[model samples]
Target: MTTNSIALFFMTDFSIPKPNHNKALKTLAPPSLAGKGAGGLGFSPLIALAAILLNLAPTPAIATTVKIDRWSTTSDRVTLKVKVLNNNRIPILGLEEQAFRVKTKDKFGNPHTLQSPEIRVLSPEESHPQQTYVAILLDMSGSMKQKDTARVKKLDGAVNAIRGFINLVKAENLPVDISIIPFGEGCNHSYQVTTKTIEDNFKSASNSELEKQLDELAKVPVCAATNIYQPLTETVKYLRNRFPPSPSEIDAQDKPLPKLSVILLSDGFHVYRNNEPQQFENVINLLKQNSQITVHTLGYGESLAHLRNRAICFKYIPDDRLTVDDVANGCRLPGSDIQEFIVDEDRLKKIAQTTGGIHEFPEDAEAVAKSLKTFFTTLREYEIIYQQPGSDRATIHPTKIEINSPDRGINTLQSETENIRMSNFIYRALTFTQRLPLLILTVFIGLVGVLPFIQWSKKLKQQSDL
Candidate 1:
């Protein structure tokens, strides 16, 4: 994705809503002057100050929305779209120059600033464009058995879903680097398949090869233990290594990394031996920590409810669970009743809510295909970027974003987008080393100056009274 393909536009009304006025002022204020008193100062001075501060404050920066017209044979690039908004419901705009300062560092430790001309002002109806790598993590454990007689196996459903997802991405002609990690006892070596090979392979995958790889999974006996933690850790390690060291280190060796999309399928409860909640928690923590990876978990069989509940309660679980039989029946019979069960509908809903992915129960192969299609459609429409306010590196920071589109009846943001929607406005202070010195200096300054000012003010007031 080249800079020209991405466009960013801003909408500025300068009209501050009542509750937002304080926040607007706070954000607009210089870091040094953030805590100054408002007093009884009237509206005019406040407005003047606000305008000056807006002009002097850092202009709102936005990630460029690049369009991937076609995959480059020489380099891989992913396109994504990012939208900017303020505390008010207004979409932020009018500061194109300021948006250019937004920088993304590649894996190689070099920073690249977003190009200004590439950002086009988006109208309310418009969407910003962007892209990234798509990392697929598949679960090939033995527990992916089918409950129904007519339905295909759970592993088959997963593989079919993956194939469809890959095809859709390729059809877009986007430069996507496809990596397949099949995890059973452990993760398989990543198949860094190129767009051409992926397309050709899908096309020429003989019915036998397709059936063997896409629909038939190695049915290890139920006794085989599922080691989900290993794969999760391995995948993350692979991604951290795969991403360019930094954004500016673009060389032949530095082909752009695809935004990561992880699809994890399993059926049994997470392996717990000894006081291993810590192990499970660690896996969850790793998933939560990576902002770049979107994890979708598909839980088949009786344990679907448990897996769905866990994934839904945590942001690390991106997609909802779909029973293997339901998906297979959906594929085989379209809208027919496949007698598939939803163990915990509310919990599954919550999982879908917490993770940015959807909860779908496919009744047949076509329905499975449809679910995959829907997921890919949402993926295409997503506004992906790697920008966290007040930080330069891609470290994990909790965020909440709410979208109130009354006209479209879109009142909520879900999945990865929902992370930007919390009400608590606390920012986790940087690590101790990064904050201690500044904290000490602040205390010293307040003691030396603010104490003296307070004393002097008190003395002056006493004299005036006398």
Candidate 2:
């Protein structure tokens, strides 16, 4: 409309109201906030509305209050335990998938975004205070009879340190299932996981059968030398059977099974059994198969570099000889085949790394106990189950899982998980077809070698008949 038409329209439609009681009340109202801009009573109506809108606007940021506890991945799913708190440092629960945005980064430092990922929030009772199972494999081999430079007997140190740890577990009142097996007492299948100290709760941990076994182990040293293979493999098998990945109880399906931590402590190298090295490898594989299991190894009393010259297997350890296979399988380090004692700190470091656990070399028995306490506290309480939509294209082992609140009211969270196995049928088939030529060539070579031998045998038989 033209300015003249606009003035005529407003004059006709919104003509000035006649003086009345309502206008008198408006005249007497507080002048500071009353609308007054277009004319004497004209309004800047947007000022209060603008303030209200700003107050209701979404907050853009908050201090980081998220910490990851522990995380693991299935072939297809990534599970994580984390602590998420609001600005008030209060745990924020009962949130839906829309409340979080998820993404992942592979071990190679490449990024992948996930879309509409499903999130399952477990109940606090089901996860946050879940029970934890720990196995303390104390070496009671003959070498325990030796003492450290501090005059602390290896056996006494192990037993006493264990005694202290058990006390700490009780003091903390942590819900745990523990096993204290003293192996290396006998050779072959003679030694076993005979001492099991388990409790549903922490109150009964003290003076349990585990303590009784500890008391007995402190006084005596085993007749045989160190045999890490038998004890470690047996422990893993026991844990796997006891706390299976798939639970049978109906209530357990909603949550995950408790994690198992195997603490393998030894002062000397592996010996006694000739196949200890191979058996140790099998133990590592077993732990790897179950992502929930972590093996924390402590090389007590000595460092890995120092143990080379003092080959415990060759010198003080009994039977003191390697089998033909043991000699062939070779030593732990780059040295004479006879120089190793099977399980050294060098090998122990690798086991911890492969299982996603930490390896610590403690100088004495006190340090050993100190390390044990540290591992127990790191157990996970809550788990987040989500499928990474980009897992199909993921090439790395342990992709990083990153979590953020859409409103930025929580800190960014990160956890790592391995990619789902290569499940594409075409990929598996292609890999097989890729190796087919080599397999066929080997078979052809074998046939060529067998035919000449068969011909020679037939000719000899014919000559004898003549």
Candidate 3:
């Protein structure tokens, strides 16, 4: 199809909501557009790149939604991560086990049920001295020095807003550890993957340490280049070191395996100074290798967005005029090559989608702050565990997940596909503390059930021998 025809097809066939640009979108609707069908669409002769990126649209604004991240099953236990968002796209936390009415189906399309449901506030990932590790990668590139309409340096705005978000996290009183990395100060030109630290360090400090470190962000000098790849690599490396890569290892060594997430706030573009782009691919590999780390991205301004357009446009701009904004933004008129920039929502979205995280484009610092608060609140999640007999393996997956809305209605959330691998579990892996009650039950069964059967069988054998 011609460029105009393709653009018209996408415009009519899908309903990907435009970014608020003025405000961060509130509700992250489940991506069920194709399932429900499309609305009327109209388009003029435009470009083809716009049509393709149309599918990459972030979660639409719809009713409440739920995403089942993954199902990790060991022989003895099952850990599930379900993310539920309200109509406003805000996360819904504090739901008790009763609220999670789960239905099950097997891979064979047969009836399946999870026996002996053990709902615990304590799991490998949450509760019982809960710990959550959050890392904030802030962009302090030279472009950050540019002032907004309010004459606020983008860096200062982000700093002040993040400071407020930290206070909000403090109020939750949950065990949340936060680390701030301000990258790209002078290192951009020097070709070093460096940061101008708030506390002059690249440490993931928690509690009061965050306040001291954040104060240094505004005063730190800005740099001319950015290596988005380095900070992403460092964040993943830190978390991987702190926690084992698999659920089995986590359950064996840790009492409560903490939740891991990273927030990348930037206003410029990604610099390839040397091999940053290639390194970015490696970083993506680490994330995909069962790290279970969610990378939430916030595009702070228009610069990054512009760069994203250019990247998309580069593929289709008339060969005669290769430099232009993305087609979706109507960069049909060619100009100089688009700059390498951040706020590249496309790149940010890819990272977030890889780890089942959220991505937002906030226009200014205040909007950025609001987005940060949403991040803090959404980190609080409900972890559910299901168990079954040691000798049997049952296909267990959540079919229907629903919750009673505060507004006097029941909101039903959809479930995604999951993988469950059963193990040859001869005995349940119970902790020493859990074994006591179970020990008593074993003795009771022996005396009342197994012991009698054994004695009768022995008596019969003796009679036959005589």
Q: Which candidate achieves the best TM-score against the true structure? A: 3
lDDT of 2 by residue, 1-466 (tens): 2111101111122367444322321325586746767445445446545555666664433434454445545444666566554333323443345444445654455666653446665533245555677787777666566666567877787788778877876776667666776666554423455324222212235548668767877766455556676677777777777767652111244444675778888776666445666776777787788766778787776643234334322222113442323332432333533322223666677777766566777767777776765454444334567764444533333344455555444345654443333222212223677789989999999999999999999999999999
Candidate 1, residues 1-466: lDDT per residue as tens digits? Answer: 2211222233345675434212321224455555555553333567766776666653432322222211111111222344332321122333232232233433443544444343222331233323444445454444454532237666566667778776766666554555555555433422332333333333221234543555434433322345555665666656655553333223255343445555554444334345555775676666566545655554444434333332222122223535433332332222432223333333333333343445554444445555565455444332333333333223322332233333322343321311121112334447899889999999999899989899999999999999
Q: RMSDs, each prediction?
A: 26.8, 29.2, 13.9
**Can you write out model 3's per-residue Cα lDDT over 323-417, one digit (the tens) per residue?**
21333343322443234233566677678777767787876777778788777766665556665333245443334434443332335545554
Q: Per-model C-alpha lDDT, please?
A: 0.43, 0.57, 0.59
Ten residues in a row with the worst lDDT in model 1? 68-77
Clashes of each: 55, 2, 12
Model 2 stretches astray by more than 4 angstroms: 1-80, 83-127, 187-190, 194-207, 247-255, 272-277, 307-343, 380-413, 417-466
**How many Å off is the CA of 227 in candidate 1?**
2.2
**What ranking of all candidate models by lDDT puts the best one first?**
3, 2, 1
Worst 10 residues of 3 by lDDT: 1-10
